[model samples]
Target chain A: MPVLEVDHLSKDFGKGRVVDDISFHVEAGEIVGLLGPNGAGKSTTIHMLLGFIDPTAGTIRIFGKSLRRNREDIFARLNMASPYAGFPNRLTVFENLMIYARLYGVAERAAKIRNLLGRLGIEELETKQMLELSFGEIARVRLAKAFLNDPQLLLLDEALGGLDPYAATLAKDVLTQLQREHGTAILYTSHNMVDVEEMCSRVIFLRRGRIIAMGGPTEVTRAILREDRKKPALSEAFIHASRGEPHAVE
Target chain B: MRLNRIAAVIERHVYDAKHNLERVTDTLYWPVMDIIVWGFLTLFLARHGNLRPGLISFLLGAAILWGMFRAFQRDLAVSFLAEVWSHNVIGLLATPLTLREYLSGLLAINLLKAIVGTAAAALVALLFYSYDFFPYLIALLPFIFVLMIFGLAVGILVTGLIVRYTTKIQSFTWSITGLIMPFSCVFYPVSALPGWMQPLALALPTTQAFEGLRQVVAGGGFSWERLWAGLALDGVYLLAAVASFDALFRSARVRGLLVRIE
Candidate 1:
């Protein structure tokens, strides 16, 4: 069974529809990229999946339970990391993690927090306040918090954004190792096409609140350049696809 | 509704208070200052024999009770504001912590602040004016409970508005109780208000509480009827506040304000 399933999700904000009818699922141990430009409803979709926003229509099922009916049960098996949201600025890194650990009811919390700090290579940042940490450090600490519960499914919304190349690479590596070791499913969103190409086994492209395309990176890349015979980068294809341009010759 | 989740939220705020000296000082400053300032005024009035008998006790009691009300109101609103300022609301809502648990945690925080502020104010009152509020503890309990419920109700309503509207109306968090204080008749009898305002003053639970406090300080017969009336009114206000909070919360979710509100 898929670890995450979103079916026919739609959200209307009275001004207009922000997320039109959309559907997708993430299987265990799979990394799926949600690719889109800004305002393409990537964040909106993630928000819905996390139950932050109530969908005007459709359903979300996690671990075979309806999200609307069994939110706590579903949330117990999933966690999310975002560069947009943050921990309390006044709290030290360790304090932030400890609080989240207790909230999620993680047993052996001290040992788990210590292990996550070491795993994320943020042991030195334990005492640092969130406001004092660099953007990269904040992202790393958030990732550590996300992994605190050993979530079965992880929703990463632009989790790699704002990091330097080295930090991004380190984050990606840790995510990969964590996924492999724990068989955690990840629904990763990013504008970094290179990271998407390297890490995502399958990509779901959204544009104007609709999925323009979905498939393996190689398959979608081939589909994007099928008629042109020129193997443009995923970023180029993404730009073209987002513009509603045809990938194949008629 | 989970104990661990509620404790976790409270723990975060406690840690925040521990780390932020400004927050600690802000909580302590008002009650202590009010006592000192009012204590001196009462002393001068008594020294000159300018005040009526029992007026000093009245002033000190009002100050301490008002401090309790303010503490409850401010702590609840600040708890919500803290989440907004830190951009932690999204993270919190995304977790298993339900809105009910979140409010419970805020109430728990308010209780802690109420205890500290009330005790500090009471202690200052005892030392500065020789006014002992402790003997009236049993009488004050219901009054304090009514004030707390009303304050919490207002705090929830204000927090809900701030969440739905973002920081545009954020000033309501602290200013709202001040706006209600006049109607509450904290320092005077409801009859002292203008004839036009008496009905409105009588409608407030705080008015009933303060009036009851005055009666207790005057050594008059305690009015159980007044306490019951205040509690019943508080129940109505509490229900309305919870409804307002729920409505605003739903609207916030629908508008995607929770994630977008900084």
Candidate 2:
């Protein structure tokens, strides 16, 4: 069964629609990429999934429960992480994660925080205040917090944007391991086409507030490159998606 | 509404207070300073005229209670502001924590801070000025309760506005209490205001609370009518504030205002 199902969801700000009737689902252990250029409504979709904003139309169900009606229950089973958000500047990394651990109702909080930090290769940061860390280190802390609950469904919005190449690779590894071990479904959005192609089992491409393409990375590339004999990279498909040219619908 | 979630938020705030010097000074240092400055002024006045007995008790008690009002109001506002400033509000909202659980934690922390700050100030007064507020506490409990409730209500209202209107809401944190101080007659009687302002002042629960505080300070027992009136106003104001917060929160979510907290 799908861990998350967002059906015909739409969002408008005043006269401007941001996410227009986009729908998708993430089954357990599947990592679905939400790919879009700037203002293509990827973040808006994530915001709606997190229940940070209300959708103008349609519904979002997680674990077969309505997000509007069972937000707390659904939220407890899921988590979101973004590089744009940080821990309290005055708090140590451990202190910050401890609060989330309790809020997420994770048992064995110490073990979880320690293990997560170790897995993220930032265990030394446990005693450091947020203000004392670099943006990349803080990104790792966010990952620790996001996965501390052992979330069944995870939403990641540019969550790996600030990490270095090595850290990003490690972070991606940790994500897939969690998915493989615990069947944690993930919905991810990032501008890094290479990362998305590598990590996502399937991709959803959005342009001007709607999904323009949805399929496996290779299939999506092939779909966008229809009628052309040359197979192309995901980045090439990204360029085509951004150019707003007509492409074969998948 | 859940205890564990609420405790989690409070735990964050406690860690915040424990680590941040500014927050530490807010709960301890500033209250101590208020008592020290005001304690000296009362002595200066006592040397001038035949002051009412327990006059030090009166002024210091007012200061202590008023400090608590500020504590309740400012702590809630500032605590929420801390999250906004650190860009951590989204991190919190993304958790399993409900709105009721979040606000309950902040208010619970406010209550704890008010009690601790009030006690600290009172302790200084007892040690230095030899003025004990405990004797008057039972008599003044109802009035103090009203004032604290009003303070928390204002905090909630200001927080909602901040959530709705993003920038410049920080001004409300510092200036709101100052704006309400005169109308509250914090240092004076309601009759001290002009006749037109008297009715306006009396409409404030803080004004009534202070009046009752003064009555008890002068050895006059509190009037049931005034206490009930203050509580009624507090109830209405509290309900309105809660409703406004709920509406503003929903509107903010609809408009994606929460994501703009930073």
Candidate 3:
């Protein structure tokens, strides 16, 4: 069974449908990238899947259980991170980690926080408040938070933003390692084509709240390249795809 | 069928508060300042003999109630705005926690603040005034509920506006209660309102709360009738606020309004 299933999910706030009949599935040990332009409803679609917002139409199932009915069950095994999400600025990096670890109900929370910080090469930053840490450090803390629960399914929404290349690589490698070790299903969202293409096995493209394309990297690439094999890079493909260009906008 | 989600919501909020102690303390500055300012004012009034002993009791009650109510309202607004500001609301939603749990957790935190703020205010008032702070204090617990529910109701109403429209109106929501001090008869009886506006005074929650406080202080014993009235009104207002909250969230989702703020 799929770890996460979004079936014809639609959300309408006022006049327009931001998430219009979008459907997709994420299986165990697989990483899926949700790619789109700035206002493409990618976030809205994810919000619905999480049960943060009620769907105007359709349903979401997690681990083959209705999201509405089995929210706590689904949430216990789920964790998410976004670089844009702010950790409490008043708390030290270690303190922030410890708080989340406790919320996850992890045993020996203090030890777990220490291990995660050490693993992230952020032991030196443990005493510094979040606002005092550099952007890259904050990003690492957020990434650490995402995995605090040893989540079975991890959601990353632009999780690499604000990280230096080295930090970004480390964060991505950790995610990849977790997928291998825990069979953690990952829903990765980013505008960075290189990272998405490199990390995700499957990709789903969204535009103004609708999925314009989906499949393996090669399949999606082929769809983007269409008749031309020697086309521009993936970033160009993303731009062309979202712009409704003749070759990639299908 | 699982209620664990509710506990999870509470856990997350308390966790966040614990982790963000600095920011939480910074946020409490306004209420703390409110106590200091009013604490001195009550002292000055008492010294001048202008604040009759009966009025001093009324003022002490109002000081505590205002602190709790304002804390409830401010915390709700700031917490929601903080999530909105950081784009974290999206992340939270992706969790198993529903909006209902999220809201209930916020309300719970506000209740905690109400208790602590009420205690601190009582201590400070004791230092500055000569009233039996504890005798009438049992009534303060329910008083906190009255203030918290009303504050939360207003907070939800404002949050609905924020999710759809500009949150510039949030300032208005926070300070609007300040007007309640004078008109709600926080420092005096509603009868003091010119013969023309007693009905207007009755419309405010503070009127009944003060009357209840006075009844307890005068040894009239607890007034079941007044307390029930306040609870009934709180229930009505809270329901209305929740309705607005639901409608606004739906409208925002449909219109993609969530993205507008983020």
Model 2 residue runs over 4 Å out of place are A228-232, B50-56
Candidate 2 differs from the real structure by a C-alpha RMSD in angstroms, to one decimal, of: 1.8
- Better candidate number, 1 or 3, judged by lDDT: 1
Which candidate should be chosen as best, given lDDT against the real structure? 2
Candidate 2 docking quality: incorrect, acceptable, medium or high: medium
For each candidate, what is the lDDT? 0.86, 0.88, 0.73
True contacts kept of each: 0.79, 0.83, 0.30
Q: Regarding TM-score, does 1 or 3 come out ahead?
A: 1
Clash count for each candidate, listed in order shown: 0, 0, 7
* CAPRI-style docking class of model 3 based on DockQ: acceptable
On the 0 to 100 scale, the lDDT of residue B48 in model 2 is: 89
Question: Model 3: chain B TM-score vs. truth?
Answer: 0.86
In model 3, how large is the Cα lDDT of residue A10?
A: 86
Clashing pairs in 2: none
TM-score of chain A of each: 0.93, 0.96, 0.93
**Cα lDDT tens digits for candidate 1, B1-262:** 6899999988998899999997787778888898999899989998898999989888889988898898788878888888889999888876888878888988888788788878888898887678888998887898889998999888889988988999888888888888889998998898899999999988889999999999999999687978998999999998999899889988998888888887
Off by over 4 Å in 1: A228-232, A247-250
Candidate 2 vs candidate 3: which has greater lDDT?
2
